[model samples]
Target: MNYNKLVKQKRVIIERCFGQMKCRFHILQYVCRIKLENVPKIIIACIVLHNVAKSLGDPDFELVEQDPDEDEGNHENDELPLRQLGQQINKKKLEYYNK
Candidate 1:
């Protein structure tokens, strides 16, 4: 049934979209603490900004490439782990990455 191509077409593209979103706005990279009703508004705003940036040809703010073998859930996201947080940052950098 050509399942490999099917998976690539569906999952890969979707993940890439999400990865791009995270790389761009960064706020989507983690869980949100906002009210449920406000979540959609914030997402919509980010989408609009994303489209505008794409249209304007903004420089890509890349942090890392999407590794196919990378574990999406590798980090202990229920709480922040030490390494992913920049080693050189001060106490002022304690805010969430997506914040």
Candidate 2:
């Protein structure tokens, strides 16, 4: 199997983990205003709690979408640069992994 293909396939697991985390912890779905240094700690705490819930055989709930009308903020303008950077990083990773 091509390394890229294998990596892409494995990516779904982490993506699903993120999805599940967002579903379990709605805070993950929205922008959190806090000190920059605490962001990782918050996310790590969520991950730890999520794992604990899973380990305890908690029921998995599907993500429920909030009303579209309630979302008034346009985030595309904010995400464009971040998305571009992510693409650049992904390309670099692919280059390194394919070598």
Candidate 3:
């Protein structure tokens, strides 16, 4: 048995399930807020609901393939300009020098 193939197969299945779950239930996208005792039940209920919705041909589960790395790309480029920061620092330096 090829380990890499097995891993890839499992990855596809798990990723698809997660994608569908998130697409259908926004609640699953974050941590649970339900009572501690009800957490298990709530999770099962959500999974059941997702499955039923899929079986009923719900279009909400339609997911696009997203590159997880794409989100982290160009994060530095998204940051605020350094010019304002430099100007502020220069003003502070001048104020200190004048003291």
Candidate 4:
């Protein structure tokens, strides 16, 4: 198979997987309140749940794709300012408390 065609096929499979993941585990779409350190574990768990649901023949999957130009509002903020490390630490602390 052509490399480009293989890549496109993989992308489609990944999109379908994510669609099944989100519908089978609604929590995947929510803003996670857990610490950043735990995010990977949560995501892995969701993937496992998605695969199990798929294997068991659960349906109701929908794919979501973001528009390419939807990030214009954050263009200026893309590069964090040098001084924001302290600000990020403070924000994380606040999020910790809020959760």
Per-residue lDDT tens digits for candidate 3, residues 25-44, read: 88878887778898778779
List per-candidate RMSD values in Å.
11.4, 18.8, 19.0, 15.1
* Clashes within 3 Å, all models in order: 0, 0, 0, 0
What are the lDDT figures for the candidates, one per model? Answer: 0.66, 0.80, 0.73, 0.71
By TM-score, the best candidate is 2
Summed over model 4, clashes come to: 0
lDDT of 4: 0.71
Better of 2 and 4 by TM-score: 2
Q: How far is candidate 4 from the true structure (C-alpha RMSD, Å)?
A: 15.1
lDDT tens readout by residue for model 4, 1-99: 999999999999888777677776777888978899998898899887566544544444676677997855755664576347547645655665587
Error of 4 at 45 (Å): 0.9
Candidate 4, residue 15: Cα displacement in angstroms equals 0.7
Per-model TM against the reference: 0.51, 0.61, 0.53, 0.53
- The best candidate by lDDT is 2
Model 2 stretches with alpha carbons more than 4 Å out: 64-99
- Alpha-carbon runs more than 4 Å astray in model 3: 60-99
Candidate 2's error at 98, in angstroms? 48
**Model 1 C-alpha lDDT per residue in residues 65-90, reported as the tens digit of each score:** 59999878855664454443333233
Model 3's number of clashes is 0
